[model samples]
Target: MTVFLIWSCSGKNASEISNETLLIVKKIEKINVLMGSAVGSSGHKPNQYENFEELKKNASKQELITLTNHSNGVVRCYSFWALALSENIDLFSIIKDHINDDTQVKTQFGCSGSTEKVGDFFINLVNPKDEDSDITKLTPDEFNKLDSLLIHKENNLYARYDAIANAVPTAYLYSKVREMVVKHNNQNALITLSKYKNPHDIELILKNRDPDEDGESGYFYTYKAIQNFPDPIFLPFLEKKLNETLDNDRYDGEWLQLYMAIASYKNQKSLELLTIPFTKVKHQDIKKYHIKFVYEAIIVNKSKLYDDLLWKIWQDENIITQEGFEYLLQLNKTKTLELSKKELNSNYQIKNTNTIPKINQSMFSQNLEENMLNFVLLNDKVFAYNVINDKIINTNVNDFEMYCSKILELKDPSFTEILFKRLKNEDNPHVYLQIVETLISFKDESINKRILETRKKNKNMNQDWGSEALDEILKKNKIK
Candidate 1:
């Protein structure tokens, strides 16, 4: 047991190190080696939860704070988690200094593992709603200083806003932040100022909008602020900027936000402007997605004009098949059934697997038989099952997993027994898991027995992520 001590007592008369700090240092070392940042049991590293539980039980606040600055990024992250769990700790004071700490830490949630910065990890840990949220525990001084601390980095803007943007009605804080915004032209500060909803700040926000920053950094907060404090006065500016983004053929997350802000106005003309991209956008990928957003906006507004436009686009096959089918089903049953059969029969060879097939029933009725009997008559059990089986056998298709997921959504009982038998044909863990899920959803009596039999034959399935997720899903559903 390496007794790593926090104190440096070299002199002969120096006091001995306390047992509390000594124990904390040892636990921190253990956590550094054995623990990864994870919440659930499915993907947790060995002893990850135990190490955190030990720290939560025995760690002194000062000792945890000392370890939070440790040279190791993972150590800092775990220590921060333990410290934030304390109910009485001033959450903002503890986190304010490390707001820009960019040390990356490996994290696991469920079956996925990802690498994220320590600062981002810390914010997410305390930012969720509940007793431990940072918002519920901030002090007056901490709240006042939040505006200043947030302006230091563009990356930290949204998080900093969440921590302190609760409309505390602090004139001094607002004025101080407004002056800082004017002097530095910080685009991030716009979100914080948006809570005030002052008309004077609108021009300031617009003046700071950088079209060059469209796809990169600052635009998310700008559009988010406009969405939060929406006004028709900002409409012309949003329209002009959105048109510029479209004309330049720039596509990104920010471009989505520009269109979303235009949609928020709920004006017929603004909604019609959104549909213009569907007709003219050159990229099919971009056009498909933007048209979906327009459809959603139209549904929200319940506008018949744009609804008819979607029907026209779907009939032309200008949009994704799923979106086209959704529009077609609303007004024309015969056409929708014809299109569904056409899509199911379309030859999906491995050579054409550039992208996963986009048809889904998640947006439509769960049972195809009830809604489209004519389509499901020949297509079900015989046609659709054969289509899936052919795609599954051709492992070179690369999108067999999507087909399996789509089958799960179809929820047809005819595919259940066949899927159980054909499960062995798929070697990909992701595809295998989807088949298992679809089988379980059927609630067939022999699922557990079949699963055990298959596992007995293929022992290596236990070693794969597919098997691990399979165990978790079965346990979660209370299936044997």
Candidate 2:
């Protein structure tokens, strides 16, 4: 679980790399110099943590350059990292050329390899689905180069992979652009790669974005190609592929990409799209795509949207079975809650942290309530929460305890009346415990009622659960 943390250059003094860092770099450089092609283990560098790492923190601009040039591949990788951090535009072309070099080392006389464009490669990795990065930590100049490189052309994966070594955005390297990114400069490269299911080579293209000094993106050709064939076989496969990939951890940013892609889908079909197997997926990120995709479809298809599919999925207990309901609760309140409220049942019980209030106040607040009310629920579930200084806290909300808490919180006597009836009729132990907890939370007054109630609920709850909870609270409060 060792994640690589690379420092990218934006616009800073490349020459200013410090000297203290150079001490370690000098050693690594010597190793590279002495060992040559065999510098790393069997032609590759050792673990990414090269010995030079210790000096990296306080490294000045000059020392950084030396460290970047050290003999090891790990060292060379850091070079890109240092340059990215510098944010100096002048170094970009230089670094770009270095990565663009198709010149492979003479491992065996002359076994040269690809000479792909590195610009597009790096950009693609940063935001695989092309979501913008929060290089805000980067100076203005640093981001400018990234913005400049987003659509730059590249020949193979090396450039992109190396670029990945240079930067790590939260959601870069999207699977959506996997096929397209591989064919950075080649117009019909994607078509060839996908075997013409996506004919015209430039079929589903990104927009006309000129990220280089020339400011000329090949969007027109790609668009014209997609338009060339209104209905292509690849589109269905593309949709299916996206749906299938939702179960994977690799597509961490699938939701963002699809959200953006669907927005641009001038002729997208919601029925077919909604029917896609988002329900069966096991990843949290992928489920998010379903919600996003549906939202986009709703906006575009409107009357044509067959929301019944969503309703069915909403009611499905197993829909979120892949991941836990707690994860579903983590979704942006504005996004899920708003959508949910539109279709959620009255007994919706939230199973996770309600950061929804925070999100509702942010830019995404538009649909807070709508999303919050969407979670599927039952009438008898316990929905109890503890408030410590007005901040609500509910420790256990597994499918076992949500509804009871919700009903217990009601000030009205009618809620209790409903629970009283359900308590007598329902034999589910979890349900009974929930009902009891609500009553206990109710007027901590009624000591006799409380003891009897606690005793009865205790019988139904987990063996030691009620006693343990009371003991812990009493230990803290030291009450009689």
Best by TM-score: 1
Q: On residues 1-480, what C-alpha lDDT tens digit does candidate 1 reach at each position?
A: 233444311112222334755565556565554244455556554565566666667666766776666666666677777777676766676567677677666766565567777766666566534365533445556544654565434444346545444435457668756764677554545666877889998887776665456344456667767866778787777767666655444456566666666666666767667767766676666666666666554544444555566655544443434434555566655555554544545552213122222333433454343233234443344655675666555534355655666667677776666666667655667766777777888776687668767766765556668778878987887777
lDDT of each: 0.60, 0.40
TM-score of each: 0.53, 0.40
Q: Which is the leading candidate under lDDT?
A: 1
Model 2 Cα lDDT, one tens digit per residue, 1-480: 222223323322234334455555555545442111224334654322354345445565555554344334434544444454454434444444344433222221122322222333233323334444521133346444644353244434354433332333322333323345453543433222222224333334433222342212223333333333334443653464455555665443334334333333344452555455455667676566566555543443333234444334545521322122223345343334433433333344434443443332222223432123213221112221111101112223343343344444444334554555455444454555555556545555553254445446544333456545644444443333
Off by over 4 Å in 2: 1-53, 79-98, 101-397, 400-443, 447-471
Report RMSD (Å) for each prediction in the order shown. 10.0, 14.3
Residue 259, model 2: Cα distance from true site in angstroms? 15
Residues forming the 10-long window of minimal summed lDDT in candidate 1: 8-17
